[model samples]
Target chain A: MKAVRTIAELREQIGEMKAASAKATIGLVPTMGYLHQGHASLIRAAKVKTDIVVVSIFVNPIQFGPGEDFETYPRDEARDLAAAEAAGADLVFLPSVDTMYPKPTKTKIAVSEVTSGLCGASRPGHFDGVTTVVGKLFHIVQPDYAFFGMKDAQQVAVIEQMVYDLNFNVTIVPCPIIREEDGLALSSRNVYLSPEERTQALVLSRSLRETKEAVKTGQIRTAGEAKELLTQIIGESPLAVIDYVEIANFPELSPLAAETAILEQEESVLMALAVKFGKTRLIDNCLIQPKGE
Target chain B: MKAVRTIAELREQIGEMKAASAKATIGLVPTMGYLHQGHASLIRAAKVKTDIVVVSIFVNPIQFGPGEDFETYPRDEARDLAAAEAAGADLVFLPSVDTMYPKPTKTKIAVSEVTSGLCGASRPGHFDGVTTVVGKLFHIVQPDYAFFGMKDAQQVAVIEQMVYDLNFNVTIVPCPIIREEDGLALSSRNVYLSPEERTQALVLSRSLRETKEAVKTGQIRTAGEAKELLTQIIGESPLAVIDYVEIANFPELSPLAAETAILEQEESVLMALAVKFGKTRLIDNCLIQPKGE
Candidate 1:
């Protein structure tokens, strides 16, 4: 595996590779360094379907807000490169801040409608930053397919909308979310969790699992009841502070009415939660699809 | 020469062509259908530097204001296709509105700073629509070079900024403005003018030519003096009503102070004017560059 840090060099390399093999299928996996098993799973999935795999690692600063964890985000290039190689990434693009943004960038890709609630509400311009950086990476890599883990389901939806709206000639593959043994979704920010906070964080996935179980048993029939049930389960942990608990229509993220019964009225909806254990903010979601559909 | 109306067919053709010759460089010229010599000049320029030239004819309704001339924008597919071929284009993409915008588009490429004044101020959301459609074309065609005329100087500036900020791989070629023998800049919209209105439209380019001559002779030293000269020359035509006549810095479109001397104080500046004769609106501009600097 080869690693490049400049846009020009990476572009030239990609250009040369395409020139050599016109039939080559390139897959791109964009990420911020601090490679967890979730990222590895994305790379492994791309390797299964593509002739070449390229992974980009850059902690995008624009996505981080004024009080967010922009400055203190994790970084370990050597370990990341080795892990990417082990997981079958052919080229690793690790661009410097100056290389990625030589000047103040004024062009922005703004996605509407679907970005209104959930993570978009709390992080403010978070999805804007993600979409912009992802746009740049797409143009740079010019891949045939791009793989993304469903851990950030909203990000996947926003990207899908952008690609469709912009008419990009690439396909977006949303892979399943990878998790720890205890069912906690794997995230790079997991490093920030202390021993006590780590244990408290399990409540996030536990609440999601409980919601899924409740829906399976037909106990939670409406969005309001679902939210109430989640709030009660998460509030049991003294360290867990619920930021938001939403039950909205899948993909569109539209709010489901409290009085509207959804027990077999609809196929399924999305149940998402955001909670804070100290300064680390984490999000988790599950799509409740009808069985055997 | 070949003409394709669907995106899938165009992409497939382009894909096969690229596969046959990886070194082939494709150039794209985007336009709305009524092709005049101005578009011809852009096509000719592209032919000089690329292996294959693709021209896209889209009316782009989103760029037009609520009360603007969108529904009545002149279009002739046969004339456009023949003109594009005669101008040395290899392919012409004439996508229908339904094909181009299959559904409501949610992705937008918003460019700021350069789009704040001039036509942008009068025609709100115009540049946003242009940038979005151009972005879609760029991704679909994946050309090596894209050409634009200096006739719409602000549009060229905004596109250049977008390509740079978004890291598009294609190079943008800014071609010279094409003009009629009477000094009127050739535009598809020029067809709207009656014979008398056409004659009165000469003031648009005459002001730009006079501005160039004044700057050359050091006659107009201040922005106020330049505007006064243009206003006097254009106001002489009873049929002509001056919309905007101002001097500003190049590219950035920053307003220059009225008292600031322009002849020797500044290396270059943009002198632009918009005028309406009868119901037809016209615009023309000239960049004043320091000679032999």
Candidate 2:
């Protein structure tokens, strides 16, 4: 496995790799460092699908809002490199902040409508940062397939929308959300949570699981009912401060009416949540398919 | 020469071309077809530099303002194909409006500061539309070098900024502005001018040429003096209506102070003009370098 820090070096390595094998396909797993099980899952999935698996580790500063964890976000290059190599990444792009952004970026890629809610609403300019960095990665890697985890559900949707709208010559392969045995979605930020707060974060996944079950059992037919169930379950945890409990049509991310029968809709429904446990804000979601498809 | 309409067919053809040649470089010339000398110049330039030269003729409607001539924009596919082929283009991608935009694009690529003045001030959402479409073309063609005519000087700057900020793996090649014997810059919109209006349009280029001569002769020292000279020369035409005659720093497109010494600045000075002859609007510019090395 090889690790590169500069774009020029990465391109040179990629060029050599391509020259070696005419039909080799590249897969990119973009991430912030301090790799968790979720990130490894993406890298491992890339290994299966592509001839060259590149894992990018950079805690993009622009994505964090003014008051957000830009300074304190986790970073462990050694651990991340080892985990990526173990998960079968052929190359690791570990660029410093300056290497990624020599100067402040004046260009921004914005996806509207879908980005107007959920995490986008709570944290402004966040999706713009994600799309811009991801765009840079896409150009730098020029991968055949770019893997993203559904753990950042809204991010996946926004990026997919950008790819579709921009005609980027790459495919977006969304991997499933990786979670702990107790059903808590794996996140690098989970390290930020206190032991007590860690336990409370599980309510996020539990509420989503129960809501999915409720929809399957025909108990929660309407978006309003699902929101209510989610709120009720999450409210039981004292440390869980709900930022948003949203039910939107999947992919399109348009809001469903409160009384709309979500189960009867043709599109898949996304039940998403954002809860603050102390200073750390964590999100999780589930996609519920329509009945009798 | 080959011509393709659908993106899928274009991609397939490009893939085959790449497979056949180990290190084939693609150069793209993006245009709204009415095959003027300017566009032909770009295609011919591409032929010299690249293994594959693709000329994309797209009349992107989104760039036109409400009162602008999007619907009335001239297109001659049969003529354009022949011109492109004659100019040494290997392929011409002539996608229909629907093929380029299946739906109204939700994604937008915006470059701030650089797009805030000049034509950007006159036409709202114009640069956004240009950048978005150009970005799409860059992705669709995946060219190693993308060419743009400096006739739209601000456009070249804006796209360069976008490419720099987004880290697009494409080099922007800004071709010299092609002009007629009378010094009128070539443009597809030249077809919209009436015979008298076309005659009056000579003032746009004439003023820019005179201004360049003035700067060279040490007659014009300040931006204000340059603008005054430009206005004086162009005002000689009775049918000409002055839209904007301004001087600014080149590439950056930042406004130069009226008192700023035109020939003393470290950066290249740009004297740009936009004049209307009856209902037709025309633009032209001249770039002046600083004092001798």
How displaced is residue B159 in candidate 1, in Å? 0.2
In model 1, pairs of residues that clash are none
Which window of 10 residues has the lowest lDDT sum in candidate 1 chain B?
Answer: B260-269
Error of 2 at B290 (Å): 1.0
Which structure among the candidates has the greatest TM-score?
2
Q: For candidate 2, write residues A102-217 as lDDT tens digits.
A: 98988999999989999999999999999999999999999999999998889999999999999998999999999899999999999999999998889999999998998888
TM-score, prediction 1: 0.97
Which candidate wins on DockQ?
2
Model 1 lDDT at residue A9: 86
How high is each candidate's interface RMSD, in Å? 0.5, 0.5
Interface RMSD of 1: 0.5
- Model 1, range B144-214, lDDT digits (tens) per residue? 99999988888988999999999998999999889999899988889899998998888888877886788
Off by over 4 Å in 2: none
Q: What is the TM-score of chain A alone in each candidate?
A: 0.97, 0.98
Which candidate tops lDDT? 2
